[model samples]
Target: MSKGKEMEGEDEIEDLCRNDSKHGSKKRLVARVGGSSSGEPQDADYSVVASLSDELALILARVPRSEYWKFTFVNKRFFSLLKSGELYKIRKEIGVKECSVFMLASGETSWWAFDRQFRSCKKLPILPSDVCFQTGDKESVCAGTHLIVSGKEFEGVVIWRYEFAANKWFKGPNMINPRCLFASATCGTCAFVAGGIGMETNWKVLNSAEKYNPETKSWEPLPGMHRKRKLCSGFCMDNKFYVIGGTNEEGKGLTCAEVFDEKKNDWDLIPNMLKDSPVSTSQSPPLVAVVNNELYSLEASSNELKVYLKGSNSWKNLGPVPVKADVARGWGVAFKSLGDELLVIGASSNSYAGHGMTICTCFPKPQADELHWRSLDKGCTNQMSHFILNCSVMGA
Candidate 1:
């Protein structure tokens, strides 16, 4: 091509690039490609540089779990992506599954959350006035992102649900019967409450069971267990619900365990846990939790942590509860599974008012013989007045 024609073509391209800015084009050519009249390259559209989904996933994965609730307010797309399963998948792939520990104070109707990343505790919003009266020995369970609390009010059985997304508490459907000290566990999408003492007639022990469907905001009765149970412990594993160690109708400690198969709509009595472990049936039902799909129980009598092995149908002692000598007694202690660690929180059993509160974390490894428990919070202030009633771990 002739030199003049080549120069003319370059000038024309530069003119188009310069006009793009004045015309408010979403994209523009780089200065290196065609000199801009402004002497600076136009900003490239970030969406064109990378897909929106990929960019959003990257950003959301790095966001701290505690700050996640605020990010949802960015916009509708941000809110949807933050709550979607796709973002969770990205978090899993990036190893960013952050678990926060939620605890309810003993006498007060207040809730407290400890953020593992920040190593700090923050008071959560107070429960609604209707449900604020619920304190002491209430049955609470976490279903998906909602915290469901079931307790007895003056009128009858009251159910309250708190959603992290909304940071608000709302009333849920009332139970079929008013009861307390019930066995509660969440499986899949529903929360199941099994045997507990009824509010009517001398607080009669109940064998009745019911499942709460959050989507429908209703409760449906399930097949009652073979025997009435009170102070029973419930856990969901293998897509089934298991109720462990509780007192019978006659106020006798129960040794037999029962498993509810949802598909079969039947409860099968499993081997007795008392026979394998030193879990005392005299006390309230032992603390049971599922971590990494493995069942663990904290036997208050022995103050030892045991893991359930399905093949042997028994619990093997993982180790003793990791805490100071005084707190190791396991009195009023609560255990929660946070990611790969077990969080233990309670006051020292030896002290009536001086011990404050003890918080410990233990990481279990199959091959490691020494499962060291790290004390995250040694009570500096006396927490004897407040009880760490229940705890739950939520991943954001």
Candidate 2:
């Protein structure tokens, strides 16, 4: 019988877990036995179920990406126990944090907010078209009800606003500069966008930054990044915007790191990240977050998230990612913490050499040796491109 036909008779979904293996990783799924449809002897059925163990659950949890959601309907048991409660259980076991990712789908980008712990996610209709809108550099400020996204077609900027109470999207202000491949973030009720190459032949790398006031529905000039940049990563640390490594005009990586202080209305220098060999390398903009007054930079190259403690003035190497990740060569990477563990999303090349997004979440370990990376069951979607966390509802 085919695999589907064989599992059709199972009943009472138990637990499925992913087990670590010497060869790599495996899974084991366990379920309670139901009345046999085959009219077989009770003893024979008993033996089969006696063999079920936690190992089976672990292996089942590792269901291949192509088969993740399909396995949800394997039996009524799985739907109730694993599929519905899967996200929550995973979060509880490992201490999960809620986050989301915005991916370009159907010629536009949309955001998906997830309760990593519950595995329950809702799609936000606020879409990114030909607009220069994205999350701002402020760690505490997120794209709330108002956001604008830029598109490459005709320098068009589209603004999307979310009504949290009704859970819907409405129109907002348009951007003066319709930019693509830009970096942005939010701080103090203002959203700032910077560092995108204009469509002009000169392909101007922008150093100018613009701020959007949601209340006023207007754009104003903020202090610009010291370095002209495009396709760079920006984050808000300690209420200061940290502009890190990015490609130059000729598509060369930079080693410089700069910060913008909103209070002072000035840009200043921060520590520059360097590879072990001191060779200038463009480390993809880190998926960054602030916790316990420390700034953590998650780098794809190192597979490690380094934390900069403000008080100590040094980086604390916490632990490496849980699973092996092969993100695309040139695409940007983002890191955010859901609940307790850290989650990372990025784009990678498939066999066809097309870019696809990958999502992996890490669980906390008492010892650094305990860190593990587990790829989430990414349903049929373009490999994850870029994502952010919108905990606005949960926070309230």
Candidate 3:
């Protein structure tokens, strides 16, 4: 390609961010983090380039995505690279991926993405999804670089995807089945969703499953599950997809879990796997995550952390987690895998007074009795400090 911009401006952008000036506008303060006016120290200067050669794209991809807004504000050429998703594509080709947390707080109009350390955050553009979709429950999963969120609208279920490359949300590419309260998990470049309630007027429970391919921007039907389940949870372990702990069509909770075998292209039922734990309507889907191929669960009824024993198809308690998952019944909490650590964000069991939240992580092991949980940073201001309605981790 031909060189497009002059690539000569010396004007540098502000350093990453500043806490929302307690009194000023949160949006303006956040915007200044990228503009040239902030008094913060100079960010590592990246000169604007005309054509994004693979070498330059590699360098840009290496930069944390939290800093990308600065480039877009200063150079149109750089903006096109981001808007066209070329830079994101280059990042994937070189095996460059960063894990960040995306959360939507209760009463918040838009979603906010925070860097892994919670050092900075950026507000996303308002999703144009209908008002009904906004008020209803939604399921979110990250496939490749896209954050796909599905929920109910006025007439039916709708899917909206936030493309990291383009930095925008687009509607459609809906599931071939289009359902809600499904079990979803991210595996490599694709996302697998299964066992949800259908959109029919009678609201039938479903056992069907499908895979979303971000590269093709379409959903491909997968073989159906053995049981019709809704409000379930899904995870990936040992290169296989597992669905666990959801109510069946009878409106009774299920203890049996199922694993999808890629080699066999079918699901194998693991009976009475969750028989040890109690299930009720008050509880959310199993608060579970896999770190280093080992499964962990934060029992929502109690504040305890437990490890799954794959050999026995059982769970072993790892002692109490720092956060209070019981108060919300596992709802409004974030339980996800952050690289090799298990990340849990919620009200503190110590003394949770308001909508504010606290974060903690642990490198879990099977037999570790007293697993040390280290508190991580919480976001600034009440805007982010509110109850978390939805949270998902994206590795892009």
TM-score on alpha carbons, each prediction: 0.72, 0.55, 0.84
Better of 1 and 3 by lDDT: 3
lDDT of 2: 0.48
Q: How accurate locally, in lDDT, is each candidate?
A: 0.66, 0.48, 0.80
Tens digit per residue, CA lDDT, model 1, 85-150: 444444444445567667775565578766873266667787764543454356677765567777
Residue lDDT tens for model 2, 109-205: 4555444432444566654334333433211124433434443333334545543323455555555654555666655445777776764436787
Which one is best on TM-score?
3
Candidate 1 local Cα displacement, residue 250, angstroms = 0.8
- Residue by residue across 248-283, what tens digits does model 3's lDDT show? 999899999999988899999999988889999668
In angstroms, the error of model 2 at 43 is: 65
Better of 1 and 2 by lDDT: 1
Separately for all candidates shown, the number of backbone clashes (residues 3 or more apart, or on different chains) is: 0, 44, 0
Query: How close to the true structure is residue 70 of candidate 1, measured as C-alpha lDDT?
Result: 65
The candidate that achieves the highest lDDT relative to the unseen native structure: 3
Error of 2 at 391 (Å): 12
Q: Which ten contiguous residues of candidate 3 have the minimum total lDDT?
A: 9-18
